[model samples]
Target chain A: MFKRGTLVVVAFVLAVLLTACGGAPAAPAAPAATDAPVAAEPFKVAVVMPSTETDLAWSQAMIDALRSIQAEMGGEAAMQISISENMFNVTDAAAALRDYASAGNQLVIAHGTQYGTSMFEVARDFPEVSFAWGTATDTGEAEGFTNVFSYNASAEEGGYVNGVIAAMLSTSNVVGIVGPVEAGDAKAYIDGFEQGVLSVKPDSTVNKTYTGSFGDTAAAAEAASTHIAAGADVLTGSAQQVVGAIGVAKERGALWLGTQSSQASLAPDIVVATQLYDWTGVLKDIIAKIQAGTLGGTAYDLTLENGGLKIVFNSAFPGVTPEMQAAVDTAIQGISSGVITVLP
Target chain B: MEQLFTLTTLTGILHSTIRLATPYLFASLGETISQRSGVLNLGVEGQMLMGAFAAFFVVVTTGSLLGGVVAAIFVGALLGLLMALVSVSFRAEQGISGIGMYLLGLGLSSLLFRLTLGSVQSVRGFAELALPGLSSIPVLGPALFKHSLLVYVAFALVPMVAYLLNRTTWGLNIRAVGDNPQAADTLGVPVIAIRYATVTVGGAMAAMGGASLSISAVNIFQENMTGGIGFIAVALVYFGGWRPVGVMLGILLFSLVSALQIWLQLVGIGIPSDLAVMLPYILTIIALALAPRRTGQPAALTRPFNRGMA
Candidate 1:
C-alpha cells in the first residue's frame, strides 16, 4: 500500500512539474475559419526590438503597434512578418537584419536607437530591403537610396511640457534631469526643457546628469539622489524606465516627471506628468506610407502637431491648479500655432 | 546640508555590501566545497542562471514565491547531478565539461524564457522583503534585513558551511578525499559518492545565489544576467583561502565596490561616474593579487579520483 501511494505521489509530482514548465504555451490557434492562409505576393517586414516586448514601455509599445498592424492584415499573413527582439548588440542587429532578408523579408524595421549604426551598415548591403530606424539623427541619406528612412518624435515639444510643469512646481527654482545617453537625440529634450523653463522661470537653473545607460536603475537612482541633494526639487528624464528617478523621488519625497510614457503610476504622489510618445501612431504612419507607396526615404519628424508626442497629467497632482493646466495648454497651442518654435 | 559622504551613506554602503555579498558568497562557498572534494564545477554560473530562470518562471506562473524557491533548488540539483555525471563518473575534463554545462544552462534558460514569454520587454520583478522587527532599525534595518529572503539565505549558509567543513565528520572525509583521493579510497571512504554529493550541493547553492538576483535584486532576467558573477565567485575561492569565512569577506569586499559606486555617485564625489563604475572590477583584481597565497587549495582538486588505483 505504501509503495502504491509513493508511486501515485511520484506521478502527481511529474504532472505538476510538466504543468509548471509548459503552462504558458503559444497563443491558442486562431479559429479554423481564421486559419485559412491568405495568398499574395509576399512583402516581408521584419521588426527588431532592442529589448523584449514584455518590458511594457518603449519596446512593448512598438510591439503592440506592430501586433495591431499584423492583425489588420488578417489573423495570418501572406507577407512574412517576422518579429525579432532582445537584440542587445550591434552585431545582433546586423545578424537579425541579414537573417530577415535571407528569409525573404523585404522591409526591415530597426526599432532601437542602439541599432542605428548597425542598421546603416547592413542597409548598405541589403539596399533592396527598405530600412526604417527609430532614432533622432539619420546618418543614412534622405531619399537618396531606395531603402533608408528615419522616424523620431519631436522630443523638444515633449521636453517643453515637462519643463513647464517643473517650472510651475519646482519650489527650489532649480530642477534636474537624468539622461540615458548624452547624444543629439537626448539633447533635443534638454533644449526643449530649457526653452520651456525659460518661458516661465527664465532664471531657473537646470542641472542635468547622464547615467550612460538606458535601464540601469541603480545608476538612475543614484543620479536622482544627487540631483535632489543639489536642491533640485523636480527631476525628469527620457531614459528607458527613468522611473528609477521617480523611485528615488519617492524615497526622498521629491517631485519628479518622466518622458515617453505615463509613468505617473510609478510614483503617483510625486510624478507631475509624463510626455507620452505615441509609438503606435508612428508605426501606423509607417504602415500607411507602405500601403500608399509614398513611403520615401525621408527623415520623419513627428511632433505634437502630428499626434506623435502628448503631455499627460496625473490626477494625483491636485496642487496643479487650473492656471497651471492652462499654462501647459497655452504652450501646446503656441507650438501648434507656430508662435513658439520648440528648438530641434 | 548633510555632507556628501556621511555616516548614513557609509551605513547604506555597508548594508548594500551585505545585500550584494550574498549571491557571491553562496556561489563561492559552493565552489569551495566542490573544489575541496577534488572536483572543479565550472558550471556554477550556468547552474545559477538556470536556477534563476526556473525560480522566476515558476513564481510568475504559480504566484507562489516559496514554491518557486523550491522549484529552483530542484532544477539546480538536477543540473548538479548532470555535471557530476559528466565530470565524476565519465571522468571528463572538469573545465570543458563545466563550460558545456554553462552553455547548455544559459542557452536552455534563455530559450525557455523567450519560448514561454513570447518576446515581451520588461517583466515585473519580485517584491522586496522587509523583516518585521529587524527592518525597523535605523541604518542597519534598511541595509540588511530589508533585502530579499534569498540574500539572508546566502549569509546563513556561510556559518553552516564553515561548520560543515571544519567540525563535521563528513567535512573531514571530504577534506581527506580532496587532499588525496587515492589515499581516501585506500582507507575505505566512498570517495566517488562524496565527490558527487559535494558537487551537487555546490550546484544547488550556486543556483540559490542566482535565484536571489532574479527573485530579489533585479527581479527581471536580462540576457547574461549572471554578468560574470560566476567568475567572481571562482576568484573568491582563491581569495578566501578556500575557507567559508574568508570567502564571505571576499564577497563582502566585492559587494562593497558595487555599493560604493552608487554611493559615490549619489554623494556627487565628482570622480566621473564611468570611472567610479570601473573601481569595483579594479579593486577585485587588486584584492586577489594582495590576498595571502600561503593557504594551499585541495591537492587533488580538478582531478578525477579513480578507486581502481587503490
Candidate 2:
C-alpha cells in the first residue's frame, strides 16, 4: 500500500512539472495589433464590469455611456454592444475578457481598475484586438504595446463643481461626505469637493467618512444617517452605494450633491447637482481612431474642458435659483480656463 | 469620551443599531430553531437573498409592504420545503445541498434584478412608528420607542419563539427527533415530518429577515443585498448556543460596536475607520473563544435519519 501511494505521488509531481514546462514561452517583443488593422464590419464592442450594470455608480455610469454611444453611432443592432457585468471575482472577469477577445470582438473594454493586469496580459495574446481600460492613465506606452488604449476621468473637475454647489446649498453651515473606498477617483472627487467648499465657505464644516466598501448599501446608509444626525443639512457622495445614501437624503429632505452619473432620477426632491461623466466624446474618438487604423497609442482623459464632464442640475430640485446658476457657471468657466486649479 | 456620549449621539447609535440588528435577529432566531431540531441549514444566506428580492419585487410592482413580506414568506417556505426534499427525503449530503441552495439564491437574485428593474429606482419603505407619549421620555424612550413596525415584530418574536420551543408538545417531538430519531420513530413521533416542518419554519424566519432589510430598512434591491449577513446569522447560532435570548444578546454586542464606529467617524475620533469596522468581528472572535467548552447543539444535527437496520 505504501509503495503504491508513493508511486501515485511521484507521478502527480512529474505530471505537474511537465505541464508547467509545456506552458507558453516568454515572448520578448510581440507584434502590434496595428499591423493587421482588422476592418470594423459592424463595430462589435464587449465590456466587463465589477458590479451590476444597474448599480448607479461606477459600472452603471459606464453602461449608460456605452448605451448612449450605441444610440449615437446607430442602434444596438449596428453598434453590437455586449456586456458581462457583476463580475466581482477578478479570475472570472479575466476569463470573460479573454473569451470576448478570442471570439472576435472588434474592441474589448475591461471597465475596472482591478482588471488592468488581466487585460494587459490578454491584450498580448491577441495582437489584433484593440483593448481599452481605466480610471487609470497608463496606456501600455512603457510596455511597448500599441493595441492598448487607457481612459481615466478628471473627477475632481466635477468634484469641485459639486463642492461649490454643496457649500452654497448647505443651510446648516455643515456638509457631510459619505465616501466609498479611498480609491483614486473617489478621493480626487472628495478632495476637490472639500477645496471648493473651503474656497467658497471656509467656516462650514466638511466631515468625511469612508465606508471601506464599494457596494455595501447598508454601510453607506449608516454613514449617511450619522452625518444627518450630526447636523449636516447638505450631503455629497460617490459610487454605487450612494443609492443607500440617496434613500436617506430623500427620507430626511437633506440636499444631496451627486457625482459620476446623473442621480436626478433618484431623490428628485433633494438632489441639487450631479457631475455626470459623459464618455460619448471619448467613446466616439476611440471608435474613430480604430476606423483610422490607430488601434491604441492615445490615452483619453475625460475632463470638463473637453466636454466630457457635464454638470447637470436636477430641474425638480426646488433650490435651483438664477443666482445659484450664475455662481456655478462662473466656477465652471474658471476651472476650464485654468484660473481655478482643482488638483486636489 | 464624555463629550461624545451626549443624548443625541446615544439616540442616533440606538436608532442605527436597531435597524442593523433587524436582519441579523430574524436570521439567527430562525436558525436557532433549525439547529435545535438537529438540522443544519447553511443556505440561510441564500434564503435571505431570495426573500429580499421577492419582497422588493412585490413591493415595487404592487406598492404594498404587506404584499411584499407575504411573498417573501411564501418564497422562504418553498425554499425550506426544497431543502427538506434535498437533504431529508433524497438523503443527500447536507453540506453540499446547502451550498447548492446558496449558489441558486446568489445567481437567481442577480438575474432577476437585472431582468426586472434594470435600473436603481427608489421604492416606498415602512414609516417609523414613534410611540407618541413614550417617545417623549428621556434617552431610552426616543431611542427604543421610535422604530418601524418590522423592528417591533423582530423584538416581539424573541419571547414568542422562546415560548414555542420550550412549552409545547410539538417542541418536545422536535427535540426528540433531533436527539434520537430512532427512539422518536419507535414512539410514533414522525421524525422525518418533524424535521421537515422545523426546517421550513426556519426558512420563513430567515426570509423575513431579508424582507426587513430590503422593504423596511433599505427600501432598494441590489444584487446580493444580504451580502453575507446570512453567514453571520449561522455564526450567531454557534455564538448564542442555540437559545433565543442568547442569540439576541450576540446580535446586540455586534451591532453596538458597529453603531459606535459610525458615530465615532462623525465625532472626529482619530481611529482609522477600517480598524473601527473590524471591532465587531474581532469581538465576535473573542466571544467564540471565551464560549463554554461544550456548545449545546442537537446530537442528530446534519445527520439524515433512516428508519431501521442501519
Candidate 3:
C-alpha cells in the first residue's frame, strides 16, 4: 500500500509536468485596442449610450437615429452603438473604450456625461481616435486633448415647447411635471418647464413631483396618477420610461406633453406632442464632420436652429387645428430661419 | 374608502401575498432545514443575488424562462456545495464562511452580469401563467391559480418540506444531529455529513427563491435587485418559529402586507406612496420585535458540533 501511494504521487507529478510542457508557447503581449494601428479604414463611429436598446425610449431613439443615418448613407458608414444601464463604474467605461478603440474606431460618441471622463482618458491614450461627449456641462478647455468634445440638448427650450402645448390644451389651468429627481441636471428642466407653462398661461398652477428614480415605471405611474387626481389637466415629465407616466395620463384622460422623444404614438389622445430631439440629425452631422475631416475634439450643442431640437405635434392632437399647426410651423420656421430666438 | 375592503381588494391582497411570499417561502424553508441541522447559513442573500443574476442572464440570452430557472437551481447547488466544504469539512465558523461565500457570489455574479449584458437599460420579462381549468374560477382565478409556476412550487414546497422534517428517517437524523450532535455521532450518524447536506439543501432552496423573483416575478435582474429579500427570508426563520409550516405562514403574512400596500396604491388611497411601499419592511421589523425569541431559535444553531463533546 505504501509503495502504491508513492508510485501514484510520482505519476501525478509527472503528469502535471508533461501537461505544462505540452502547453502552447506564451503569446506576445498584445497592444491595447486603443493603441493599435489606425489606417485609412471605414469610418468607425461608436455610440456609447446610457441604457440598453430594449428601454424603448431615449436610448432606443438614439439607436433608431444611428440606424436611419446608416440607412440613408447607404450603409457606407459603420456606426456601432454600445449601451450601458446605470453603469457609472469607471472600469466598465474603460473596458468599453478599450474595446472600441482596439477596433480602430476613429470616432467615439458618449451619449451621457457620466462616461465623459473615462472616454476622454481613453481618447488621450489613443491620441488618434476622436471622442465626443453629449453633456450638460462645459468641457474646461482645449489642449493636446485634440479628441474630446462635449454636447448638450436645448432641454430648456424643449421644456418651453411642452409648456406651450400644455397651457393651450389644459382645461383646469393646473399642470404638473413628474420629474425623476429634484436636483442637479433635472433641476434645469423643472425650472424651464415651469417658466414655459407660466409664460403661456400665467395663472396655470404647475405642480411638480419627483419620483426619485429614473427607471421605476411603477413609481412614475403612481406619481402621475397623484398629479392627475390633484386636478392637473395636463401632465409632463423629464423621466425616462415616461411612457408609464403617459399611461397614467391616458387612463385619467388628461393631456400629456412629451419629453426626450416623440411619444405621440404611446397615447395619441393624451400625448399632444413631444419636444423632440432629432438625434438622427445629430448623429448624421457627427458622421458628416468625420467625413469632412473637420470633427473637433470639443463637444457640440445642436438646438432648434441646428435641426437638433424641436417640438413635434401629432396630427391627431385635438387643440392642434390647421391654424394652430400653421402657427407652430411658422414659429418653427422663424426659429430655424433666425427670425425668432428662444433662449435658455 | 369602505370599498377598499371589498372582495376585489381582498382577492388582490391574497394574490399579491402569494407573489411576494413565493421567494420568501423557498428561502426560509432552506434556512429552517439548515438551522435544524446545527448549521446557520448566512450566505442566503449572496446565493439569492447569484440566482437572480443567473436566471436573468439565462432568460435574456436563451429567451427560455424554463432554462433560466433550471440554470439558477444548478448554479445555486454548486454554490451550496462550496459553503458545505468550508463550514463542514474545515470546521470553520459557519457564519464567517457563509458570509465569505456570499461576498464571493455577489461580486462574481455582478461582474459576470455586467460583462455579458453590457448594462442595457431593460430586459423583457416572462408573462404570467394562467392555469387552464383552475384559472377560470372566480376570485381565486387571478389571485391563486394565475401565477408563475415558481409561485406554485414555493407553496408546494411548504407541505413537502414539513413532511420531510417530520416523518422521515433523514429528518430524524437531522433533528438528532442538531439537538445533540455527540449523541447522534455515537449512534453511527455522520454528524458533519448530515449538517453539510442540510446546509447545502438550504442554500439551493434560497437560490430557487431568488430565481423565482428574477425569472418569474420581475423577469429582469437589476443591480442589488433581490432588494433585501434574502435578509428578510433569513429573518423569517425567526418569524416561522424555525419550522416549515411556520415559515410558510410567516412568508404569507409578510406578502399580505406587501399586497395590501400595492392595492392601496392602485386604488389611490390617501397615503404617501413611499410609505405604502415601506409597509412590508415595517411589518418585518414588527414581527422581529414581537416574536418570543427563546422559543423560536434552535438550541444548537450556529454552534459547530464535535463528537468528543458527548
Candidate 4:
C-alpha cells in the first residue's frame, strides 16, 4: 500500500512539473476582420501589462487604445498586435519584452511603470526594436538608450475634474480618497483630487487614506467602508484595486469618482464619473515616430488638450446636475488651456 | 482624536474588524487543525486563491452561491489531497512541497480565470443576514449581528473545533498521531489516515476562508486578491499555540489593529499612513513575542510516518 501511494505521489508531482514547464498558451485578442488584403509583412506591436487586459483600469485602457489604433490603421493586416497579460513580476515582464523583441515585434510597449528598468535593459539589447513604457516621461536619453520611449498622462487634470464634480454632488461635504500608494500616478491623482475639492467647496472635509498596496482589494474595501463611516457621501480613488471600493460604494449608495479609466460600468448607479486615460494619441505618435525611423529618445504626455485624458460622466446616474456639469466642464477647459494649473 | 470616540465611529470600526477578520479566522483555524495533525501547509494562501477563484467563477456562471462554495471546498480538498500525497506518501520535505503547492494553486487559478472569465467581474454575493431582533440593538447589534451567514459559520466553528480537538475520541487519535506517530502506530492507531484526514479538512476550511472573502466580504475576485492573508493565517497558528479559541483571539487582535489604523486615517490623524499600516504587523509581533512559551506544538509535525522505521 505504501509503495502504491508513493508511486501515485510521484506521478502527481511529475504531472504538476510537466504542466508548469509547458506554460499556458498565450491567448491573443481575436484579430479584427477587414476586407482589405493582408499585408505581406505587417507592422507588429507587442504589449506587456502588469494585470489582465480586462482589468477595466490601467491595463484595459492601453488594450482599448491598441484595438482602437488597429481599427483606424485598417485592422490586423495593417497593424498586427500581441499581448502578454498578468506580467506583474519584473523578471517575467523583462523576459516577455526580450521574447517579443526577438520575435521581431517593431514596437514593444511595457504598460506598467514598474517595467521601466526592465524595459530599458531589454531595449539596450535590441537596438532596432522601439520600446515604450509609462506613467513616466523619462525616455532613457540620459541613460543613453535611444531605442526606448516613455509616456505619461497628466492624470491630475482629470483627477481635478472628477474632484470638482464629486464635491459639487457631495451632500455630506466630506469626500474620501482611497489611494493605493503615495507614489507614482496614484499620488498625483490623489493630490489633484484634494486640491480640486478644496477649490470647489473650500469648507468641505477631504479625507485621504493610502492602503499602501496596488492590489489589496480587501484593504481597499475596508478603507472605503471607513470613508463612508466618516460621513463621506462621495469617494474617489485610482488604480485597478478600486473595483473593491466600487463594490462597497454601490452597496452603501455612495457616489464614486474614478480615475485611470471609466469605471461606471462597475456600478452604474454609484460611479458618477471617471477620469479616463486614452492612450491612442500616445500610441499613434509612437507608431508614427517608429515608422519614420525615429526609434526613441522622445517622451510624450497625455493631456486634456491632446484629447488623451477625458472625464466621462455616467449618464445612468442622475446626480450630475446641469450646474455640476458646467462646473466640471469649466475645470476641464481651465486645466487644458493652461489658464488654471492643476498642480501648484 | 476626540471625535474618533463617537458611537458611529466605534460601531463602524467594530463592524469592519469583524468583516476583515473572517478570512483570517477561517484560514488560521484550518491551519491549526492541520498543524495539530503533524503537517504544516504553507500553501494555505495558494489554496485560498484557488478557492476564491472557484467560488467567484461558479457564482458568475451559475448564479448559485451554494454551488460556488461547494466548488471552493472541492478544489481546496483536492489541493490538500495533493499535499498529503506529496508530504505523507512520498516523504518529501514538507516545507518545499507546501511552497510548490502554493505556486501551483496560484498559477492554476489565474490560468483558469483567464481562460474562463477572461476579466474582472463582480457578482451579487451573500447578503447581510441581519438577525431580526438582535440586529436592532443599537451599537452592538449593528456591529456584530448584521453580517452574512458565512461570518456566523466561521465564528461558530471555533467552539466546535475546540470540542473536537479536546473532547472527541477521533480528536484524541489525531493528537496522538501528531504527537508521536511511531508510538501511535505501535498502539494500533491509524497514523497515516488521521494525518490525511486532518490535512484534507484543513484544505477545505482554508478554501472556505477564501470563499468567505470573495463571496461574503468583497463580493469580487482579483488576481492575488487574498493578498498575504494565507501566510498570515499560518503565523497566526503559532500565535494561537494551535488552539481554535486562541486563533480566534489572535485574528481579532490583528484585524482590530488594522481597523483602528483605517479609522485613524479616516479621522485625519496626522500620523503617516505608512506607519499606520504597519501598526497591525508590529502589534502582532509584539503579542507573539510576549505569548506563552510554545507548548502546544505537535511533536511529530512535518515528519512523514512509516511503520517499522526508527
Assess candidate 4 and give its TM-score to the true structure.
0.91
Q: Candidate 2: count the clashes.
A: 0
Whole-model lDDT values for every prediction:
0.75, 0.85, 0.70, 0.88
User: How displaced is residue B18 in candidate 1, in Å?
Assistant: 2.2
Considering every candidate listed, which one attains the maximal lDDT? 4
The per-residue C-alpha lDDT of model 3 at residue A328 equals 56
Docking class of 2: acceptable
Candidate 2 chain B has its poorest 10 consecutive residues by lDDT at: B292-301
Ranking by lDDT: 4, 2, 1, 3
Q: Which prediction has more favorable DockQ, 1 or 4?
A: 4
Better of 1 and 2 by DockQ: 2
CA shift at B232, candidate 1, in angstroms? 3.0
Cα RMSD for predicted model 3:
9.6
lDDT per residue for candidate 3 within B1-310, as digits (tens), equals: 5646777656656676677788888888988999988788888888988887788788778888778878778888888888878877777898798789778876787678768874433234455578898887887786798776788888899888888888999998998888878788899998988987898788788888878766665545555556467778888888888788888888888877766665565455667755776787898888878886657566677778765864
Point out the higher-scoring one by TM-score: 2 or 3: 2
Model 4, residue B74: displacement in angstroms?
Answer: 2.5
Q: What share of the true interface contacts does candidate 1 keep?
A: 0.08
The sequence of per-residue lDDT tens digits that candidate 3 reaches over residues A210-309 is: 6545665544654565566456888888745465566557755788887666767557776787776667765666666655565455456657677777
Deviating ranges (above 4 Å) for candidate 4: A1-40, B136-138, B289-292
For candidate 4, lDDT tens digit of each residue in A1-344? 99999999999999998886765443333245345445235789999998777777888899999999999988977898999987878899999999999877989999989999888889999998999999888998887889888889888888888888878889899999999878888888888898899899999999999898877888898899889988999998888888888878887789999888788877888888888899988889888887767899888888888888888888898777889888988888888788888882
When 1 and 3 are scored with TM-score, the better candidate is 1
